[model samples]
Target: MTDFRSRCIAPEPLAGLFCAIPHPTGVEICAATGPDFLCLDGEHAPIDRERAEEMIRAAQLHRVPVIMRVPGHLPDSIAGALDSGADGVLVPRVSTADEARAAVAATRYPPVGVRGVGPGRAAGFGYRIPDYLATANSRILLAIQAETPGALENIEEISTVEGVDVIFIGPGDLGVTLGALGPEGRPKLMAAITRITKVSRAAGKAVGMFCASPDEVQGWRELGITFFLIGNDARHLADAAGAAVARAREGF
Candidate 1:
């Protein structure tokens, strides 16, 4: 398995595309597209554990890291993704330091955290249990979403939590919180994003965010965001298909 956590903290920037289609083939295609990692969306997408594991396997085959955005900051939610062989779990709606710590603990085993032992795919189906256990705590990456006003207020404290690797900003939800969206709200959203990135960097943590376009990615990159989850598979497909149809209608 790729040591995604190590790559995340490396000096170079890490870029990843999101997958919301819940299919291994889509994940494989994204991995082949050559991003540093791929984030499987379980929070907004209808991906179950089985499908998530399949996607992880696909990404692994391509030697690309896969991080799942689990639905919430719950033990089962976080563990399900890790146990499914995901390189890490991105817990959404993490609004406080305690919530961030809980998300981190869920990804680890006892003493360090409360994750239970299981001979699942992550352990190579019992064959690599000893090896897996020996390094799982440190190997597994943990990220929490800083998407709401509450999360923004406690961003510093959350970033300081031990075991937390990334602090991802959810711009859409954040815009909602700030009562700003679209072009009119871009300034406020950008300000919040900059603040989150600065705070996370100050705490020695990686900053991550979602970007739908190259322009957005460039903008965030300039602000010192090394970890990026770009456009999802579904949107990419739809956009391509729509463009293709439009070209055909234009008769070359």
Candidate 2:
């Protein structure tokens, strides 16, 4: 029987991968490599229901928490990810409090949230001695990505969403909206991130994001960021692979 996860460190980095690679072994291999946490792309990646389960199992074995990023806010997909055993979930493009609440509801079961409860792999089935429900709500890291001009405008409202444990800054998408990343020294994007973090901390929620380097992380950390995700699987692999290829070609 596996131990129930009472809590997991939220993933984060200044700039990290969103892991597009398919296959459980690939996920497993990436997990073993250790790069903050893996945001399993249940949304864009070619992973089906069965493979999601396989990947979760492997993540558990490696003792690395996996955040399942659902394709959208669809109820069924959200329900499936939680039931399948992801440590937490990252709902993308969440621009409203209602959508954020819906995502939180999908991950929990009654009282705390609205997820259906059942003895399954995530709970170690009936084998799990300690009740999985004992602290599931606090254990589940509910995060919503604030990635658009709409979300930034509603940053305070979105940050106040109930059951939303963390607010992540999707700066890339937000950056384009405010025009080229360099202009105004990213004041617009910076303001959005700061607003979300400010409101979240005031409301007693965690703040996190996808940081590219340690400097970005340090900046966010100073801003009270906690459950951040550093990078993804595919980027790590691509970076390493590219360097290897470059080194090999250098002889030519």
Candidate 3:
């Protein structure tokens, strides 16, 4: 599997899709299609650790790295995702450098941060604890969301936070927060995204964001942001299914 962090920082853009179906089969299907990575959504989906672990195992079977978008910044949430053997953790709503630091702290171990050691799946069930501990702090990618106005104001500081591999912009929530939804608000939202990308690049951090359509990829890439999560499992399924049904109805 390509290292998630390396993929994020590489010059070529990393393309990924969010797997929100909360099932191993769903993840397997997406992985088989081959993306640079897969983000299993724990924030909006009903996925628990067991399910996330199962999904991770499924994706790794295809040698696809997985980043778990944990529901919150709490230690336990981050720990659960990492323990499930997620390639990284994406913490949402991280508005300040302090919150970013806290998120990274929970992700690293001991002297580096506060994460307690555990012989979880990522450690090969206690068999590879030493190796896992020796490398995890560096191997695991730490991505924090910049979705609020506060995050926009503090983008420079947050981007400079150590161990924060990717500064992901949650355009949807941010649009809502900035009242930058729809046509009128899109310019405002894009402006915020542009600012985040600019500051993050200056700080040598990878920038990521959610794109509603594939067409937006190249445009965003021009902004020096590489990581992108465009579309999701549910949307793909629904679109294909609907298209098929529409075709069948036309025949009828």
Number of the top candidate by TM-score? 3
Clashes per prediction?
A: 0, 16, 0
| Model 2: lowest-lDDT 10 consecutive positions | 1-10
lDDT of candidate 1 over 145-165, digit per residue (tens)? 899998889988988999998
1 or 3, greater by lDDT: 3
lDDT ranking of the models: 3, 1, 2
lDDT of 2 by residue, 165-213 (tens): 6677777777876573887757767787788778877876666677655
Candidate 3 per-residue lDDT, tens place, 136-169, comes to: 9988998899999999999989998998999999
- Best model per lDDT: 3
> TM per model?
0.96, 0.83, 0.97
Candidate 1 accuracy as lDDT? 0.87
Instruction: After superposing candidate 3 on the true structure, give the runs of residues whose Cα lies further than 4 Å from its correct spot.
Output: none
- Whole-model Cα lDDT of every candidate shown, in order: 0.87, 0.72, 0.91
